[model samples]
Target: MNQDFQEAVRDTPGGTAEGQVAVVTGGANGLGEVIVRRLHSGGCRVAVADLDGHAATALAEELDGTRATARGYAADVSIRAALEQLLADVLADFHGVHILVNNAARTQAKPLLEITPDELDAVMAVNFNGMFNACQIFGAYLAEHGYGRIVNMASLAGQNGGTATGGHYASSKGAIISATKVFARELAPRGVTVNAVSPGPQDSPMVRSIVGEENLESYRRTIPVGRLGNPAFIAEMVALLASPDAASVTGACWDANGGLYMR
Candidate 1:
């Protein structure tokens, strides 16, 4: 880590996130982008880690020269070696990590019978195993530091056996929910809180790609709220879960589904 950067992070208003560092995977676009924006606005220096480094860098530049500094790193969350390097780089740049948002995921919807082993494995690797890897690596750092926040992005599909995303995607998200509980249990005593945000269908690029433009209107009508959720709405939920106000919240799954799934 650069000594100057470390000093900057240490001197951050609140220490943990006032200017402290946060890592957001899949932060180039869609819900990830919204989350990054919200965290930046909250005065956190953010590392936008994504497979698409170009887009991530662009977003960083957009937020540069502000109270919150942003950096872009290209990484494939599914690969352990890549994640190891990503974490090391983040620590080197910021001196220490305070927050981690495991938001990288892929939703490949297909009938259960039609899904191949490779397909299932790929989804599991990114959505579930990727989160596991992050928690293991960063969770250790958080425990050492004695404070941290982790918000895993899950989906309504995980809870309801999936209305939109079927098979592999749903299973992977279910695993995310389970992992959140396990992580919270293990890290709570260290002042690290782990939680999950399971969002319903949102107006995101992924949603548009999955639902299609022709069916978007019909899908919106099906939700009780009469509209697909916006990225900002989901971002608000994430912000709250990641904030000190939610200190008592851990090992919990929050449903931001516009009443689509009530539990």
Candidate 2:
């Protein structure tokens, strides 16, 4: 970690997340990386889990002795076996899991007519099934321990039929939102709060790939905020939901879309 960044994190106050153990999937890059850093600065023990083991481990090393406790794990969120192992490892290493951020997702930009079966399935597997696997495995741990906070990453695309990635991506995210509601209801009795964060077009790696340069300017113009969303904004929202302050908030979809999709 940069000494300057570490110092800044240590000095910051107001939203202290001390003693919380959080698992952020897809934490190796882009928005996920930003979220991991923010959670760390807020004084939480963070586990940066991603499919890329090297990246995950590298991030962990970077924050090894910073203000917040940190570690990394490589696991495929889409696979049940891998997710099971990940939950076990996280529980064993951290002693308990307090928060789970289901941020791992994939998008397809193909038109409906040209969408292939395999491609569609791949998107669903990563966006929807991956969330289920994490929720089921991690939720179990939280339930056993009697407390947890779960934040599922949905998208404005899911709410508005997808502006860039097409129907397949939208469908998967919609499923995530529905799943969030279901999990919140089922887990509430166990002292677990489950919610979804639906962000509009952001300048993340995932959005950049789906929203090409030619259309990026036009898309920004269409948003009521007249600018692209920031990863920090989304990270802050996730941190809030994961905090004990949001204990009463459950089964709600927090929209961070910059007025792109109002409901």
Cα lDDT, all candidates: 0.85, 0.84
Worst 10 residues of 1 by lDDT: 8-17
TM-scores of the candidates in the order shown: 0.90, 0.90
Q: Per-residue lDDT of 70-174 in model 1, one digit per residue for the tens?
A: 888998999988999999998787667778999999877678888899988999999999999999998988778777789999999999887467688999899
Give the TM-score comparing model 1 with the true structure, all chains together. Answer: 0.90
RMSD of each: 3.4, 5.7
Which segments of candidate 1 are over 4 A away from where they belong?
A: 1-16, 65-68
**lDDT tens digits by residue: candidate 2, 109-220:** 7788788898888888888999998999889878776778899999998898863686888999999999999999999998889999998878876676666778888878
- Steric clash pairs (candidate 1): 1-92
